[model samples]
Target: MKGLILAAGRGSRLLPISATRPKHTLPVGGVPIIMRAVQALREAGIDDIGIVTSASSEAALRDVTLGSGHLTFIRQAEALGTGDATLCARTFLEGQPTLLYLGDNLFGDSLRPVMDALDGADAVIGVKRVPNPQAYGVAVVEGGLLRRLVEKPRTPESDLAACGVFAFQPRVLDDVADLPPSTRGEIEFPEALTAILARGGRVRALEFTGFWSDAGTPRDLLDTNAYFLAELRPRVQGQVVNSQVTGTVVVEPGAVVENCTLTGPVWIGPHARVSGSAVGPFVSIGAHSHVSGASIRDSLVDAFTRVQSPERALSRAVVGRHALIGPPGEEGLQLVVGDRSVVRL
Candidate 1:
């Protein structure tokens, strides 16, 4: 089975981070978010993947998936809604049964069950009960079939929120093509789902009770990191020196830790360096990064970053790649720096 990953949206909520890299490229547990999706598809026996991306993200997307033969890229010229992004991959789809995943959504369960159910249904949508369905594309399911879908209704009739994972027969492309642009000037997938329902197409809902998260905003990313860490429990594997650690922590191979205090629930990626610092409780240091003479708690430091003395970063922050923090005389406080950014203080 082929898979379609919709990664075209410009993640405005993520701001500076998304400005430099696509949301899919954001690191979660030291791995790019989209790579996680790719692994999930591969694990489900679907190696052939098609990614629909906006032109702005083409280069970064290619760089991330380098040497992956089963992957293909299609450019969506506009940030049209989910329906249009899926339509961008229509040429490569070639009438095969396809699995569609939102680039931002992460699921804990294997996708095989939904894939199996797709054989008998026109479309299979992953749904989960959420406390606030009114904020999502809510689904009403009856007798194991999806009865209706209301897109962000003010008063939702159900708690079954669409989780943005869908398996659809190729014929669903027709519905996508026929959909007119929504008031927001983007082709909406919920509209296509509605069209399918009106045509007597059976839409199956897989009520997943496992872990799932969509990292659309900064807070969401932090929450997802904590959620996955509950299960991942990454352990430090490389040499350590002069560091104090407490609780659960994972340091990947070749990582260096010295003169640092790492509280539990922290992950230091491969080849990363943690020196003369107080880290963790909730922290993820990306590969090849260095942190010294600093205090970081509840933060994510991306690849190749350097955090020197007189630096203190607190709750819910992301420091991007190749960044330099703390020049000669700088104040210590909370900071979120983008890729290649430099801060004097």
Candidate 2:
């Protein structure tokens, strides 16, 4: 089987940060969101991976997946729906079974169930029982089969929201060709599944109860980072001087934390420095980033960023790569901020 991840959508909800960077480009526990999904697909023994990305995000996506060989990148020329993104990989798919995983979807555990379920069903969808199914694409199951599927229904018929991971046979490509634009003006993928049912094709549903995040918004990005960081093993390979590093924290080589008290479930990337700061519980400090004299928790500081705030309490903050969060200078001051960056006092 092959693996295809759809990452063509413009994450409008995660604006300011995602304005330039794709939502899946955001890091979760030092690993980019798309990289984590790719890793999961690799662990499932599906190495021939095809990523469906927008023309704009193709470069950023490729930069993160350098070492991952056997990857085929297909750029969707337009901002199409998930259905179009998946169909764009038809040449690479070649009628073989393909596991379709949404780029932003994250799971706390392994994706072994996806491969196992595809053996019996013509199509297998990953479903999650959520509190508010109206906000998600939900699957209405009858017996063991998916009877119906709805995306963001006003009154959901079921609480089993489709978690954006599915195992699809080559028949879905035919279904896609048979599809027309929905009322919302996009070639919705759910329409393809509906076509499958109309053709008497069997589609089963697999329920997953693990930690999941679509990472559609900035808040979701922060929470998902914290969730993944909690699973890391404790290892401090860096310099910790006059710092109390407790719990399951990973201080990678070349990182230095001095005169700080760090709590568990955190990861400090290589060459990162945190001095005279209070950071903890759920945080990830990216490579070469510096955080000093600040109180940060449940936040992610990306690579090459510098944050210096003596009494600022930063929680649930996502500092993007190469950002500067310190005070501005006057004599020879220079500010080189990226496009669509956010700056707030």
Name the candidate that leads on TM-score. Answer: 2
The residue ranges of model 1 lying beyond 4 angstroms of the native Cα positions read 67-69, 311-313, 327-345
By summed lDDT, the worst window of 10 consecutive residues in model 2 runs over 326-335
Write one digit per residue (lDDT tens) for candidate 1, span 147-260. Answer: 999889999998999998999999999998999999999898767778999999999999999888898877789878776655666466887897787888889999999988
- Runs of candidate 2 exceeding 4 Å displacement: 327-345
TM-score for candidate 2, please give it: 0.93
Q: What is the lDDT of residue 324 in candidate 2?
A: 70
Among all candidates shown, the one with the greatest lDDT: 2
lDDT of 1: 0.85
TM-score of each: 0.91, 0.93
What is residue 239's positional error in candidate 1, in angstroms?
A: 2.1
- Ten contiguous residues with the weakest lDDT in model 1: 336-345
